[model samples]
Target: MRAAEHRRELVTLAYPVYAELLSGVTAGIINMVWVARLGGHAVAAVAVATNVENLLLGVIFVAGSGTTVLVARARGAGDRAATHSAVRGGWALWAVITPVVAVGGYLCREPLARLLLGGGEGGSLRLATGYFAIALPGIAVLFATNVVDGILKGMGDTRTPMRLAAVANGSILVLDPLLILGCGLGVRGAAIATVLGRSAALACGLVVLHRGRASRRPAEAAECGIGSLGADARRTARTGLPMSADFVVRMAGALALVAVVARIGVDEVAAYGIATKAMYVATMAFYSVRQAAAIHTAHLLGAGHDQRRAVGRQALLLSGALGLSALLILLTAAPWIMRAFGSQGEVAEAGALYLRCLGPYLVLLACFIALGGVFEGSGASPALARVTLCGTTLQLALAYGLSGWGLPGICLAMASSMALQCAAVGRMYLRTGRMGRTERPPATGSEADRPWIPAAAASDETH
Candidate 1:
């Protein structure tokens, strides 16, 4: 495909993903808004609960992301049996994982809340436990919905997932006030509202999945022979585990960075928190492009094309533009952005400075993150995950050493770490280009031993 065509397809896939991501963030903010009226303890309880939810999201990525790449590849190769196996793999993994998380989490709700709340014996601890009691079980709904979204995205339908997110968030928006205040259910009500909203969306998503062509199986597909459930589950887990590790490492690194920021002083820590939230707006856009690139690259590869170089180039271009735009916006409007978040005085000044200093780091992070999708689609994610782990460890050490210089020093550490990561991934990208030219695609069943050729591509390479 032409460069312009590749860029256009990426934009088509990315924008809806961006919207869906932004909406989820927006809903979280609004959900907090409703909880804030209940007082500081209430706010604290819900905040900690939601943070746990974010971590749990990384766990479920095993099913969701793995299914997406596999299904997209199968679709491109027109392998109906492979597609069926991929979908089953996702659900099987979900089934095996959900009970452990949901039921176990509920049983340990009090202990979990105490751990999260620093073992405090207070109203906040009690509220948090109550919130967990409901939210933990409700996680089953969230996991299933993510699988549905993954399947839809793999089938080249990003808009539907965007709409489904809107449906869920909209329902939460309507339900929050009614349950939290009107019914006097407190933090538990917020948890209930979230679960109920997600449940509604899950119902709609299942209906959509049933009607979609991707979920259908004809007699011909039966002839193609579906893999056993254990085999399918293992395949999906192997494909997705690296991606999930990458996400969890990043999340853990971000959390640890907060502790490093705290060493600078409480005001700086507050500033760091608000600034990071604002940064999410841009980061989400970069991730959307990454997702789009992964989908497009996997699809093309499944169709017997080695176009990773082309897709990675476009992903970098798109994400670079977004990063540059965000940098300029932050530089020009840092103070205003801080004010919008309700910070003032020393806090606002510190946050504005932090935002202004974030330009280089954001740009490098955009490129690194975007390139990662190409690796993921081509079955090179294990290497990508290793780089991420090393980079994150380096970042924390650098940040700890540089805390003396305040947020700007911290920004420098982040930028330095991300630059090294980008160089690493850039070398990998170049190697793939060399391999594409010098080597034939790997044989079928040999993908496990290869680095760049995916299983689907291995089967379809002759095309």
Candidate 2:
């Protein structure tokens, strides 16, 4: 049996990373809540601008994804030289990538905002452009933070980023009004505040890593050891690429869904803003488990554990629990949660109703995420990306079609899509037999499933 403390250590590391992600998101939701009253135009602007930002975030996600794989494997293998080398290489790459993203964001801001917001003459286009312009230059901050964060995550240090996120979000809370209504910054102010918060997060992460300092002592201390960063960037690239693809493609589809919603009118957009916010809170546990399971599975795969099946099973089980928990929260909090966000009774009612519809489908959402862990662990990122492509495409198509039916249509569309996506992914996963100890039939298994087992060498045992 695994030591109680060992299991807890894994859980502990995952907690802060999840919290960091959720807290920053919470801050965004609160910010959006206040923005909703400013006007639907403003809400639409923020949504489009945020989606643009997420697009950029998807690009850098590969860097973090690569870092996590490198860190997990190197540390698992006790290769101190390789770990430090990777740390240095990661920093070097970000120095180049950050500025590139920032400049691109700055230049693309107006056109992209116009496109996503659909450029109405109501001055909404100008407002969204304003937000996007300011948000664009801060790409450097966002890039730097995520890259450093990936390194930290690889090291099993989720809390460092989480604490930093809290600081960043707190700054946003303080700076939002100062820039927006106070100095007459409006959307620009909000954008600036977000940028500064990201910069702060990057700064905190830098300090944490430098202090932790890479060591070539894996031969001496089992835990602190890491392999050389001498591994090909291409390999890291190959590993992380699918993860980035999944995020980027899925986000692209999400934005497309938003664009469709925009056509339904700003009121629908505002309603969605409120509902999505509530949904995120209700769904944090799912996000948390998926992230934790992915990282843990990566480490386990690296360590050559014999329990791939067990790990996969546990991750999925955790995901189901999380999804069920989200459902209960959605069902129970549907009314009050909506009421808390928007002052408009109809908006609140619509959002609450939407949440209730989304409740059961949380099951599908969680399971899909669990499957992502398997792909990440096995380094079959192509599979991971394909899974995302199929699921998101289906979801997007449904969302686009159902949106014409109004609020319920939008909710049902996405929820139903999630169900279909999960089933598709789960079926493929079972067929692959990557999750289990034996190359047993998937109840009926992917081409990768064979009689051969890639066992960790006898000398590589962790404890």
Q: In terms of lDDT, which candidate is strongest?
A: 1
Instruction: Mark the 10 consecutive residues where model 2 has the least summed lDDT.
Output: 439-448
Off by over 4 Å in 2: 1-10, 29-44, 120-123, 181-184, 213-231, 259-270, 343-345, 399-416, 431-454, 457-463
- For residues 240-296, write the lDDT of model 2, one tens digit per residue: 677889888877886677777886777777777778766665456665655665666
> Model 1: residues >4 Å from true position, as ranges?
218-221, 433-463
User: CA lDDT, every prediction?
Assistant: 0.87, 0.67
Candidate 1 local lDDT, 113-191, one digit each (tens): 9998899799999999999999999999999999999888888889998998999999999999999999999899999
- Residue 384 in candidate 1, Cα distance off native in Å: 0.6
Among these predictions, the greatest TM-score belongs to 1
